[model samples]
Target: MTADISTPSRALDTDSTLPADAAAPASVTFADLGLPATILRAVTDLGFTIPSAIQEKAIPALVSGRDITGVAQTGTGKTAAFGLPMLAALDPSLRRVQALVLTPTRELAMQVAEAIETFAAHVDGLQVVAVYGGSPYQPQQRALRAGAQVVVGTPGRVMDHLERGSLVLDDIRYLVLDEADEMLRMGFAEDVEKIFGQAPTKRQVALFSATMPPQIRRVAAQHLNDPVEIAVTRQSSTVTSVRQTYAVVPFRHKTGALARILATSDADAAIVFTRTRGAAEEVGSALVERGVSAATISGDVAQKDREKIVERLRSGALDVLVATDVAARGLDVDRIGLVVNFDLPGEPEAYVHRIGRTGRAGRTGEAMSFVTPQERGRLRSIERTIRATLEEVEIPSPADVSAHKVRSLLTQVAARQEAGRLSMYQGLVREYVTEHGIDPIELAAALAALAVGDDGPRAREEQERFEAEREQARAARRTADVRGPRREGDRPERSRGVRRDAAGTRYRLSVGHTHGAQPGGIVGALTNEAGLNGSDVGKIDIFPSFSLVDILAPLDADAMDRISRARVAGKPLRIKLDEGAPVSRARTARPTGDRPRGAHGPAGRHDERRTERREWAPRDGAERKPRHRTA
Candidate 1:
């Protein structure tokens, strides 16, 4: 795949020039884009008075049955750009997957489907259903059987239904690939190609992506017929309204640092991006423990409930939303005054999307990224893409946090005064002063403490206690790791083969069982430092003082050095390529009988009996392993 990616237009500043085809009158509305009355009415009802540049140009092309390749960033109303035209062009009477929209994540698929439903709300007898991997099959299957006109789904799950004869596309009139580049990044290129093959040849294709990578351009050139290439990314890479800043936060103290940062920032609400679903939960819980009202949305969360969480975020009921990028798709909230990169995005384009969640309505929003000492390059890449240097900021001091808290308390007091209330509290304060026999000045100080939530102890003291304990724990683990391989309890289901993609390369990493390294930690490090998805990481074998991991390809010296600096289980990875054969033999396998359940003993004390590795030959033309059923 050579770099077939078409160059995007000039800078995206407000005054920047746009593509020749994208020119439109500032007064143009969605109704002026030749959409049918039903969709136009829906647009009006949805408060879409004007058309986005992409929507303006794309709706017309797609309505006329010409292919379109929309190149735009996230939060540019791309969903509406494709959905309006697809809805307007669909013949609702002939219902058998008339239009199929493919998104990268289940959350995005649900978002697109919901928008499609909203756009087609007035269209009579039209049915829409979103199908993805996480949810049960029965509901999606039922929707299809009930004559759904439009089906939106992720690629792998869509492929599943297609293979099972559940989602027939024979009558498919329109095929839309949303976030095509994201799908590729998630390793769904093959599945998307298969889907392209399955869809009807005589169909309109509308493809949109934030980037035009080589693979995407290749796919577009191969599948699209004289496509209208609309590029809307001719503006400043990062928004001018977003004051970008970063802090050098150590990974161990990250949670505490996050608490302090959030406390001191003037943000009304914020979104903290994490690397994985598990990490999202962890960070969210940590924030809650630190007295922040936080919630988490990830692939683990049900589609039905994500709306409520995001609504809370928008309503300012939730102060912080800890989320992974996949789960936070289409999460628009105007009140968000901050965006925190708890974990840097795995891709540069994702960085833009994360920050774009805020600074909406031409309002200034602050974005803060927590960069580890090892992740400077990731920071640099983001700066290169955003075309602006992020201001390096220092972590908030304890005094700063305390001052912010005092300010917040004073603001609350002022609001109460403005409300002209609190007589009940005043009466109580008088009663307390009389009952306790305290001086008026002392009584006033006590009341102030109560208002400021001074729980008769110092907040700094507690934070220091927590930090000291964590440091001690880290030290203890480092000391224990040097002794020998510690017996791993609560281990994952022992599988023989370390699974890797076909093109994956094997690497050996120091600090394995002895260092308390687990597959989860390795996955975390790779996602953070190597910019690789969990799926891109292959088989992992835990050995004494070392481990073997399978990755997509051999990393160059710089990447390998970055991995070496990355920590897993509080130990530096110190990675090196494993030129030796992949550890596929059965001797490397640990069977059930090797150790008693819940057993924990020193390395040399355990028995070394192991299961022989056996060749996994396909039986009677059966598949050795099937493609994963999620895109």
Candidate 2:
């Protein structure tokens, strides 16, 4: 059935129209949708009882060989909606690439590929290959040459394979664009168009996006023939059972802030969402160091390893899973009681999807987002989209963390006591009291301190120190805000501020103006990777080829290594001590202005590039410098 596809600028109501619910009944199952037994068995094994709104509407049309454009949000069973139908129609005996699914990110590609593999499990000889960047190309090339019937990948990597002749679409009968709008947003429009050109003209196409922007609609009009248009709109974007809140945190203190939040939260399990894969690794590692049982999942993580991590989360062996948005797609874990947005999502749709990970199956959940002062606007957009105003909350302080930890330990002790396993420990404690002639209460208190690793005064000192650094970071940001953006003329002013601290150490970074490196991005990279506060970072000089920054002296080898590996403007810092040259002066111009408009081109015209990563962490031995926070 044909339908009028409406765009914001125009409408195509001349064609026939079909009701979205025409085929879907109040009770519709996979069997009712005419899915083959092979696909049905996998669906049943996945424990899916009924189809989702989009799946109910789109499955029949797709399986019937009709091109379709679907409007549905992420996490609404979009994968199964398209995947099951595609699998039902594919020829397993044909070992060529019969189908290609293009996604916006590597994480999404990996997720879609895995889901399709599960759906095609009962269909023998049906091989699915996932290819994306940030991984070795040799393995992907080998997989492509192995006669895989289905290939799922990001547009950039797919183009790379096409140019290299490793992947051929001559026999492609099915082409799907998942999250089409996101691909366009990430500047993959050109790559996507080129892929469309390479695919066979007779292929059946399916395009699904959360929103139908003008560009996407235009593409559909130009390519899709008398297509079926299906839209699944939600009355509300957020789950009512999820208690949502926001915390205002400086970027440099987010890691510490997140640690405190997790320590205090009563959630059975948590998922921390970061915007970039690098941030996921960094945050996951930092959480482990801070004694949180956390693991990371991203595009870079292998599919088999991701399954293991999810299993750990399900079996209660892991308390937290740090992931990028695309990495966590289709991840279902009933115990996820909390979802923390370490970095506010760029899109409100993503915010909804992130929080949806929790509050599932009628269970109440909690979602907390960490927002820098500059991100207050984005936070408002999210509220508008979710149709709920999130209550503002405070990050737990060091004292709060300590108290929570103690409470948790005491609860464990109570459980151990109830289990009646304390006889040996009690006897030992009694002997110690008798030998020392100490009060039983005093001895017990001492043992409890030892058990909890409370080093008396030193523990108090450490807590106080952390609190001080946190406050210092806040104050530095406030001062920077009042002073406004720094200029080349402000270098001397910055120099005076640096000299006030213990002699700062100068470090050089490989990224500079030529790499689109800006001071705010550099500071963010350092604070996030090195776990240093904004206050701890020093003067930044953006030269043409390389930049120099002053940091607190005597950084440990581990911190230095992290800093060296930190990335800014899509390039590693490769940071080192700036002892090579006595530069006369720093660059006079600010690098924060808009890039040459036509040079890199506008938002939609540029080639796909990695979005700049934003985050922070904490470290020691850095002298306080003037600090600034970017939105």
TM-score of each: 0.56, 0.61
Candidate 1 positional error at 336, Å: 6.6
lDDT of 2 by residue, 443-547 (tens): 766766676677689878878887887787678568746765334233322222223323256677888667877665676556545645344555666655677
Instruction: Predict model 1's lDDT versus the native.
Output: 0.68
Model 2 lDDT on a 0 to 1 scale: 0.71
Name model 1 segments beyond 4 Å from true. Answer: 1-27, 71-77, 92-95, 104-111, 114-118, 121-128, 134-139, 179-189, 209-222, 232-234, 237-242, 246-365, 369-381, 391-403, 407-446, 457-631
Best by TM-score: 2
Question: Residue 169, candidate 1: how far off, in angstroms?
Answer: 1.4
Clash number for candidate 1 = 11
| lDDT score for residue 179 of model 1 | 83
**lDDT by candidate, in order shown:** 0.68, 0.71
